[model samples]
Target chain A: MPGEHPQTLTRSTVAVRSASAPAAPDAETLHEIHRQERASVTGAPVTAPLLPAERALLRSVEHAVLDERRLLTATELSALAALPDSAVMALASLAHQVRLTWCGPAVEVEGILSAKTGGCPEDCHFCSQSSRFDTTVKATPFLDTDEVLEAARQTAALGASEFCIVLAIRGPDERTLARILELVPLVHAETGLNVAVSAGILTKDQARRLAEGGVHRYNHNLETARSFFSEVVTTHSFQERVDTCQLVREEGMELCCGALLGMGESDEQRIELLSELQDLDPTEVPVNFLNPRPGTPLGDRAPVGAWEAVRWIALFRLALPGVILRYAGGREITLRDLQAIGMTAGINALIVGNYLTTLGRSSADDLQMLDDLRMPVAALTVAF
Target chain B: MTQLPAADSAPAFCTGCGQSSASCPGCGRDFDPPRYCSACGRWMGVTVTPSGWTARCKEHGEQHSA
Candidate 1:
């Protein structure tokens, strides 16, 4: 949208067609003229028809991202989502090109250790850890420092570059905050892993302390668009979540954030969520397709289809070209055998080993998948 | 590298005053004492030593001092 546009064809279509025309009309100019003519004749602006192989909108986005390395505007991104199925393959191909250009062929693998499990007070509709839910997850006390260190050591041995300590709570109280400050440095010192945390809604002071303690990144997912947020979680406002992310950034810690897909949100809402995330400009975006754990409110919701998942991943890459796009929870169940296809669709990172409440495929399988794709596993330090 | 005793094997009472229920050094409020906070009412399964303290809370999850 910010690029140069030639203004000749709109004045005279005959002149555009003539051999003696000063210069051949570019595709953009021609399309603009067609749109204007259709508007004048039919009283409505219409997109010029695209050929089966040449999806104009998708091609324009591809050119902007892959060739010019420019970020796509929201309008251009919306047009990409509206592309017909015939253009899906080309969209994926261009997204892959953009991924390679901006992020390169190295895949970053991160492992998550649920340091604290269950007994959460928040009632997020999709989560199994909520005390209100009748799910099978049993509440367990936080692991001991040595146990957490052992887990971090194991995660490092598994070849994951990043290790996250996740807790299930609305927010960390003073004592909990003190404990995190303690564990962070030790994990870094012993395991040499880039430590991250997913403590729920954080205060500014908590964020500052986490930053001071050598926590490399702070993950607090926006979860969904602001409009659809209340439908997902009622106890906290979406602004509260945004505030925590801002606090993390204010403290100079890298923000690893994203949302869960296939939670009955509309495509428009997904676009809105992406637009917000683009504004947030997180260092990493973990896209989790809802696995719909049993006994949760959204348990009966359907999983996102494989092709739909690929499309969303491609769209996310197109929308946030420079950010790290991770294949997070529910990939095993939602993507099924087409997991490799997601890699080609623009995912550059993965949560190796088990997820928070669900079992993921083994780390070896994930490594082998990367090998098969000819993308090397990037070193831990390389990710930052 | 400083070696810490295993968390499960650490003393469950305050190391400073050797009391089960004492005022918190942090907030200065009466609590179940060290290792656990009574004011916050969160389990801070911690152990304090001459070198430093290692604290872990069931609600807060993990924390330590080098």
Candidate 2:
């Protein structure tokens, strides 16, 4: 088990396993969505029966996503979010159907290596890698070629088709770019894994160079909705991250943009992110719940509950039916034993081994989960 | 990790610095105590919280974060 970086920070089945797996969360496990007043986007009470109006809303959204193969608007997503906790299971079932219809059952497994650990210049408040924080993380230089190759080989052994070289920096400079370009091919040659990079923001030329260097995908998380972004990290604007994502796509590399949830954002704000993602159109959306790193700005915040996490996973899938909805970091502590529920809740791909700074569930356990669910692990090749 | 390190088993290197010395300035950040024993790679039991943290390798006793 990967202990949290102390910074830090699957699936399976084709058919529905349990309709009410997430069931209604009891008071002890009430979702953070209920703790705040934001769920009032709908006039219906939590105890309100699914009025004809609300049912029609869900059915309309379902028809658009499942029948028309279209994306949901922000208002539609809000209706889903405002659903009584009892409707979460039904929402999940609909999301599961959407995943099966749009993305199919083959799960993509990936392994990530923090090639350069810690000492990040930018202060993304949720991260422990920032040098600005008083975190206990030990900073290390880039791993040697041999070490990088070894990690790639380890990734390959885990049946992962994708391997990401993650570096903690604002962006890659000349030396860092050279090292990454050099390593991308060697990793591909050694492991036959699709190479991905998450080196923060990028310039237009840099994005072009990486794409030319056999980098198939680039990861740069939007972290949260633009409305709540400045509340967390002041080092950089959300626009910069979006620009890098746009640059990656413009350079012909697949963009892997994502969001980090549970950072005190509202349900409407989360819907806003989903809505923006509709315009961004990333090939993959890695859903990361906040694990709450100690010594960071978000350290004291409560982690997103497991059931709530599943609800959003389904929502992500429903909102973006075509993208690879990956179960990313912070899941171990966030989901614990209920991890399998996510598989049925519209999660189509996952990071198999360790994460950037956090240890994940054993690769064996994750693979076994796929096997148990009868979902085969397959590599994905999506268009830009 | 799949197995627990035996008591008196060797301490494994830090996942952070890749060294056995947990005292290294670069090692032991957000991790609880230690999931794997320092001298060995056996999975340990670690519980972490706001006030304090503990990692026990079964064989190597226990240590908190530096």
| Separate DockQ for every predicted complex | 0.02, 0.06
Q: Lowest-lDDT window of 10 residues in candidate 2 chain B?
A: B45-54
Per-residue lDDT tens digits for candidate 1, residues A224-334, read 989999999999999999999989989988898888998888887888898889888889999999988767999899899887788889999998888889999889888
**For model 1 chain A, where is the 10-residue window of minimal lDDT?**
A44-53
How far does residue A219 in candidate 1 sit from its true spot (Å)?
0.4
What is the per-residue lDDT of model 2 for residues A1-384, given as tens digits with 9 covering 90 to 100?
A: 243112111121111123323223232223343424335545543333333334344555666776677787776677677666656676777888888888888899888888887789888889988998976554667878987887788788888898889999999999999999999999999989999999998999999999999998999999899999999989999899889989999999988989999999999999999988888999999999897886899989998998788889988988999899898988888888978889888998998766765667666788899899888899875521
Docking class of 1: incorrect
CA lDDT, every prediction? 0.74, 0.76
Q: Give model 1's share of reference contacts.
A: 0.00
Best-performing candidate as measured by lDDT: 2
TM-score of 1: 0.74
